[model samples]
Target: MSKVLQFACHFFAVCVSSNTPTAVYLGIMKHNGVPVDADLMKSRQQEAEQQMQRIRNEIIMLIGDVEIGANCGTKAFEDYLYQTLKLPVMKVTASNKEAADDASMIMLKEWCDANRPELSSLFTLVQECRKWSKIKSTYIDGYLKYLNSATGRIHPDFFALSTETGRMNCKTPKAQNLPRKSNDPIRVRNFIKAPEDHLILSLDFSQIELRVGAFYCRDRTMMETYKNGGDIHAATTSVIFSCTYEEAQDKHRKEYKEQRTIVKNVNFGTFYGLFPKGLQSTLKFKAGVEKSVDECEAIIRNLKSGYSALTTWQEETKRDAAGKMYIETWLGRRRYLSNIRSENWGLKSFAERCALNTPIQVTAADILKLAIVRILEGLPSRPWLKPILQIHDELTFIIPKEKLNEAVIFIRECMEQQPFPEFDLPLVAEASAGESFGNLEELEG
Candidate 1:
């Protein structure tokens, strides 16, 4: 009746496809109620094109300069070639695009390897342009075209139990993948709005994954940070950079800011089992610290030393999963990883990472599912409240103006209730409400 252990069978039941919990919620909420700002999306699409064009022009100009006898080696020339020119590390070999544009044939990773320090900015720009371009094409134009002209609604099909980690999947318009809190100009989230008499209330778990990780690993410093209501990133920064906790508190300080960013990358990435190469790319692109592979390895070594228990715990989990050839969430949801015993090194590593990450992520998903079930069961009593969208760690609802305060209280209570006995620590959720989905302000308790 609980459907907890049913995931193993449900995963392979390809013949049975019908309305899931998410789909039922979607039907009840009715996408027609969500307002789409067509003009705004079109403007965003245009701006995205302009931004891509500008970045392309800048890259083309830089490439033209590099085309004129740029030496591949030497620190001085490498600095000029990779850093200054922002050229990707490329192999001098025949390529399919050589006949069209010689520059197009250059491998991004190979070029970056040759010139990591200098190409971060260039790579960032390229990545930004490509990301925005895709956002424009997919969400802005593609999704917009799919919108019902009469209702201005897009009904994206939702797969409730699609992912092994128990995450929801969306297709057709891909509602789940819409940009939420990015600097992208074309944010599709802007289109989903509440009706005239209602407001969109969003409740999101605050650092749920990290909190779960700390609980599982039993890392004292991390536990203390949570226990004392201190900033996790700041605490980590102080530990990593050898700065006083007071010093780390100053977010404006350049050193403190960089340390905080590094700690964030380390915190989120470690649970997902990041390697030095992955860390290097994150450092260079996201944190803007262009370190070589060797430097990245050293940083990783230091981080592992600092948080050895987490590393050890992850390794142990991976080994256990490799041996068992499957893993389960804390709430008994199973992920039968057939590839865990794979001979292929890449497949083996992937399975290992899945082993390490699945428990935490899957448990988080289970909690959310429980919370949703609770909310839905309770919603029958309160006819004014309607669940709308569920982002990864956040749930959104549309409620009447009069019931806003009551809905907020109900949501907060439901989410923080801790449905699983394994969770000893209190779950913290941040709630916000706004006239529309995109524009939300925190509701201070």
Candidate 2:
């Protein structure tokens, strides 16, 4: 116990100076609590339950008396998908069992669309049923369970040191996990509402990680894209598909639309030493775009060639990490990669990827924290401004309706400030305002 206490004291001494401001701000934010619309949440819960029941009945009619569990994760459902329906197993669990998870279902649905058109509806219904179930059980019921009866709000606990990359984590309702507008069919974000005359304002850093990656790699094409205010994704699309930048940016062309999406995903992952197989899986499962491994290889090859410095940086980073057994952000937050020198291919490969990812991601996280500290410093003069939530790359607050302009300007100034003296690229934070969390409109400059 004495030895453990000594180690803990040393750890605290090292981190306390850097983390104190964030800790203080998070404590105050938790105490403030997020205002909830109890009546609206309850109504949404009821509507979601009804939708779940309808979907459940439809699933039952499709698969007669299969005895699939509530989440469709039962052995019975596995048999129904693989043995009964004869759908090929696109993915498997860690134990090598046939997987019935959402990704698997999506892959199966795509297969059905191509080969067995009749079975596609079954997978569609299953996907809808699962989505509704998640909203009810995870978001609605989970949030209600923690709602404070006295305050009529939910107070989530935030941990600053929980993640390895120094990103914040929220729990006791997981406020940070709230779905975006595209994914939230039930408008779960609407549950968090501003008090009578107050409005919700959000400031999000635009493409921050990509910007950081360009700074680190010094990739001329990437740096030039941001420096000139060009669309990075569209620029990448041009490189990947061998088209003119205008053709890649053309909204009317279907091929450009699909290829641009693939390029966007690739750009986000490429800096992290994304491999061909991993790219293939990411495209298929996450983006729902089917790409063969060879095709994914070609896309990556083109990306590396276009952004020539990227491959150079990746190789140099991996070599340095392997030698030192650690990597660090620009702010000097170190993440040790013990497996960087491991003999096993998988372990060593994962460590190498972490070596590439930690610097870009952790630097971005540090910039956000710096903004939080600035907001905390400025909050005393503006007592009406209330900091509520910090999602990835975004900070949300509740402010007086009349103070919308004031709050937006102050918050944007704090967020757009240079995080460190060495960070050369201009940082941008887009602001939005609305009465509810779901319906925010971008505030033009």
lDDT of each: 0.71, 0.88
What is the Cα-based lDDT of residue 306 in candidate 1? 71
RMSD (Cα, Å) for all candidates, in order, is: 7.0, 3.3
- Tell me how far the alpha carbon of residue 165 in candidate 2 is from the true structure, in angstroms, after superposition: 1.0
Q: 54, model 1: CA deviation in Å?
A: 7.7
What is the per-residue lDDT of model 1 for residues 166-186, given as tens digits with 9 covering 90 to 100?
776667766667664655565
Error of 1 at 288 (Å): 2.5
Model 1: colliding residue pairs? 83-118, 88-111, 89-111
Q: How much is the lDDT of residue 348 in candidate 2?
A: 97
How far residue 436's Cα lies from its native spot in candidate 2, in Å, is 0.4
TM-scores for every predicted model: 0.78, 0.93
